[model samples]
Target: MTRNIAMKILLSFLILVAVSACASRQVALVPEDKPFSARKNAEIALLYWIDSLPHVLTTGVDNLIPSPARAAAFQSALEALLRDDPGLAATAAETAGYQVVIFNFGDIRFLALADSRHPGIGPTVIVNPNARRELIAGAPHPVFEEGVDIEAGLFVTRLEARAAIIAGAHACASSVASRCATADNVCPGNGSAPVRVSDAAHNTVLLYQLAHETLAHAWPDSIVFSLRGMMRADNAIVIFSDGSRRHAGVEALPNRLRDGVAATSLSSAGKIVSCQDADDDTLARRSFCGAGNVQGRFLNGSPDACSVDASASSGRFVHLEQGGIVLARLRSAAQLNLSGSAAENLLRGIAAVIPSSEMPMASPDSASGPGQDRR
Candidate 1:
């Protein structure tokens, strides 16, 4: 009996030693946590802002600014992004109520700022501060940043960020690996104010920031129009399943026929065009579809059907009038490009030019109903 007891004690000792050694290895691999700073917070916020800008802008174009001028416009936008970097950081930090640390990952040349405010929230979880972090973290990579070359720069940045997060993740019990040290009960790092907590958060934030910057550079025209359209429309982008989206109240249409169905509700295709009912049955007669189909009449379901012609330009501007005054004028404007702010302005101008006598405010009943569209 004594021999059995002695053997058991020896086995327990060996197990303890093995566990200790494993923990030591883990701690040795991770970086020591340090103080967080304003720069880091700014970096995190910037990345998030950049990453999310594309979707936001895409959704609100037409009613916002209009079409953008590529050459001169893109440069101006890049400058603006750099200018706003600091403000973004301040906002993110204030929101978290904690300091942050940042690191430039060597591979992608991307930046990762650690938000260590709550070590309990998983180490280094990347954040799109303006949006939900949980959603951002798991989102597809391309959704955030653009022009990520496989060879260098931002690619390296992403790698280093991941490594750092992995290093510091032990701070939270949920992220703490079994191999973590007992002495610390967390990652082997000082929970310094503004210090980056781990890789996950850092990576996610950087991804978002890069995405924003990239989109800003790629689609300046879209940005201006989206904002401008929102201001004019006073409505939000309504998502649809056919991979096509709509920003109503910004663009004028005649009827609501979608996907061969009445535009009385959400649709997958072919609906009637609709608008704020004014007097111009022409503007109220047609609808734009995801497949580039435009059809319908600007009739108020009256015995007298009014035939009208409307045209959609590249930048998503649709011009329609009593006898095509807006469409004819816009079509003749050789300088007008529908893909930029100018196009948005043209759309706005078209809306403004039509005398109230011609345009009609749509009845609330004519509007698309909710959930009429299937994903």
Candidate 2:
């Protein structure tokens, strides 16, 4: 076990080195859906943070919702549980040169849903008792001295990624469903099953069902759009080489959950989540566009009812890390809000919780991309 842990640490170190080099490129950035400015890009690397254990679906994607038992399970899972199956698709994507890495912040932040109200969502910051009194003073949402975690971060923003994932899942389902048209057990591998969205699971589960269909493919490679800051679900910490590219997906969908406390298991290390655009068709483009095509959608599905104040709408994470919004922070911000005010006070508070600081930190002026500093 010791050796295994050591190897895991070593592997993480190597990845850190590679990702760091990529971040320093200072090359022209490309949109997530668009081709990389440079073609030799052998690998499409995706890095994200997750805070919880993803809910495990028992009766396939088709049945997770219609069955009241399943919904209860889903809601129950809203809090606890973690499994490692998404890696299967990640490996398959690697076949096509897609690299996906995840850092589990679950150790520092656990899975918790937003209050569904005006939740003060932002990067995890340490609030000095004094600072907390000043900024969060009259604010209903005070940065608690200790044991208070942001409930809605990347997890809630998943709605944006869901748009892309679902679109790809549909394409995958179409492909796999075609395989079983003539007979059962004809799909592929051990689980060549058909997906029926009409099965009546919750929308989220239904989306997963569509995504899981790609698993039946010899190689399920779909696109994953990480658009949570628009939803203000994450601290907006840029943990990937293409931080600017990833942030482009902002404001893609209606604030999926405009108001909530979102510090999720979404960015947790070792666990990767994304719905890749498995097929290159119109649906895929539209989905990606909807997620974040040039700061907003190309196709307007319906007027976004969530944003009461367009300026005040989501993007709360962007606000928390606003100053460095253009460039990736890679390091955690201590700013009180989007203004990117100094985080010194917040750090004093953070010392109480993360005194040792497993999370990375960067100075205000030096805006480097994501890396845990592998060297």
Among these predictions, the greatest TM-score belongs to: 2
lDDT per residue, candidate 2, 43-84, as tens digits? Answer: 111112211212222223332222444333322222111122
Q: How far does residue 154 in candidate 1 sit from its true spot (Å)?
A: 12
| lDDT of candidate 1 over 175-219, digit per residue (tens) | 212221112111234343221212221221222223322332232
Provide the lowest-lDDT 10-residue window in model 1.
Answer: 223-232
TM-score of each: 0.17, 0.22
* Candidate 2: worst-modelled 10 consecutive residues by lDDT: 129-138
Off by over 4 Å in 2: 1-66, 79-287, 291-375
Residue 237 lDDT in candidate 1: 19
What candidate 1 gets wrong by more than 4 Å, as runs, is 1-96, 101-107, 112-114, 119-375
Q: What's model 2's overall lDDT?
A: 0.20
Model 2 vs. true fold: TM: 0.22
